[model samples]
Target: MTFKELIEQRAQEKNLLFVPMAHRFQEGKQVYRLGHVMLYLDRNVIFVFNGKTWVPTSLQSLLDMAG
Candidate 1:
């Protein structure tokens, strides 16, 4: 599976939300619910929302936390 698809699958397994960076904002508000994650394909990285900013994070780090 593709990286994006893998992320989506893992996120689902962990019950965490996954969203594309493009849809980050909607109606002037963040589209992702608080405590969710955003995928930035351009940078080929993932970021987690810390209630303020999108913080860069690694997939392994997230998986470690999930387990």
Candidate 2:
């Protein structure tokens, strides 16, 4: 199975929330690499991928930035 599909299934099974990086940033899928499955635990607690590692960010801050 593809990475995206795999992640979707796993998220459903684990009851975890997931949103693709493409969708989260309001970008097109073609902008991101294929099979890029970046799933976070919840909307309140988001995990951001820096060049080195995943870092946590609050939903409120994310909302602020989006506006």
What 10-residue stretch in candidate 1 is worst by lDDT?
Answer: 30-39
**lDDT, candidate 2, 1-67, per-residue tens:** 7544564465556555545445443122221221233424333345545457656665444333333
Off by over 4 Å in 2: 21-67
Clashes of each: 0, 0
lDDT of each: 0.55, 0.42
Give TM-scores for every candidate, taking all chains together and pairing residue i with residue i: 0.46, 0.33
Model 1 misplaced regions, further than 4 Å: 15-41, 63-67
**RMSD in Å for candidate 1, one decimal?**
5.2
